[model samples]
Target: MSHLVIDIGNSRTKIAIFDDHKLVKNDVLEDLTEEKLRDYLKENSIQQSIISSVRDGIERLENVLIEQTVYIRFSAALNTNINNQYKSPETLGLDRLAGVIGAKALYPGENCLVIDLGTCITYDAIDNDNVYKGGSISPGLNMRLRAMHELTGRLPLIPLDDFDGSEGNNTGTSMLSGVVNGTFLEMAGFIEQYRAQYSELRVILCGGDANFFDTRLKNSIFAHTLKTEPDLVLIGLNEVINQQ
Candidate 1:
């Protein structure tokens, strides 16, 4: 049987097709219209669909999925293995759940740190015990740059790009240093802290900026002895939806 998984985020929506637990195809789109989405679904032999959306257009997408398949799973807050140390569990984002699911499935029997670098950079932890302990979230690369520009009068809204090295020379470069470099350090520091706590910690990085960060900081312990799964969230959503 085939499975379809869609993750609707703040900036973009990702669609993936899975045959059973194995991924068949994946795509990222800026606009998600039901008509276009339905046309894509026609190509896949989908028997079920799992959707995780932070946006409001999912009701329409749900109708499209229902038109194609009988089983349509929409992720929501639940008494899951993931510990909700956060004040409000319902407020937690669905993308985080997808990342955690990916970590659990891809790196079973290991303690994993899942970092997603989309509009908001999120860190989630799944321990060796299979307990999903919550992690942290911070402004993403683009958001940080935009925040600097919006909050101040002089700072310009710069694009999200990594400097070749740790240092940046010019003002624009300095902004990159403060935002992108700082983000890399933040990730490295978090991984270091986790490593101190758990000897068997394994790191997995995903999202749009993950490749840039991974390429620049692959020498760090977290990046060196780690895995980068770009389609981790899609895979996770597929796995969870299939379970139901």
Candidate 2:
């Protein structure tokens, strides 16, 4: 049977079609409309649908999903085989929980660290006991750059491009180094810290910036443990669907 999963985030939305847990189609779109959902349902024999949205005002999208297929509303309370120990279960990001769920599916009983790098970078950890004690969240690459531009009078909004390495000679390059390289180093540091605590830690990277961070960290000290799973959230969302 076919299942559809959609993750609605701050900047964009991701839609994935899974054929009994095997991903069949995935797409990222800036605008999510009823027509798009209709088209997807129209093109495929989607049997069930699930959605996890971080942004509010998705009542319309929810309506469309309910209309299209046997919709399953994904949330933290869904019957997933994991222990969610977050202090504020109501406030916990479903995306974060989804990442943790994805990591659990990959590692099963082992400790897992999920670093989702998107509009904002989020770190989530689930222990070998399947207990999830939330991680940290920080500004992502573009958000950092944008903050420098909007928050400061001097820093200009610089487009993301190749980082030239050397501490950057000019203002723009310096911003690039601090924004991009800084993020890499920050992730490296997190990996280092988590690895120190959890010896059998399996690091899973996801979100829009996962590939870039994954490639950049390949030669780092934590390379052996780090894994880049771009479709992680979708996988977790699918897990939620199947578990139910």
Taking the tens digit of each residue's C-alpha lDDT, what string does model 1 give over 80-186?
44444555667768889878877888878888889899999998887887776578999998898888999998987777644555577777788988887789889
Candidate 2 residue pairs in backbone clash: none
Q: Residue 227 error for model 1, in Å?
A: 0.8
- RMSD (Å) of each candidate, 1 decimal: 2.0, 1.3
Write model 2 residue lDDT over 6-91, tens digit each, in one string. Answer: 99998899999999879989999997898888887888888898888998888887888787689987777777898887888889
Q: Can you tell me which runs of candidate 2 are displaced by over 4 Å?
A: 162-166
Off by over 4 Å in 1: 77-87, 162-166
Give the clash count for each candidate: 0, 0
Clashes of 1: 0
The residue pairs found clashing in candidate 1 are none
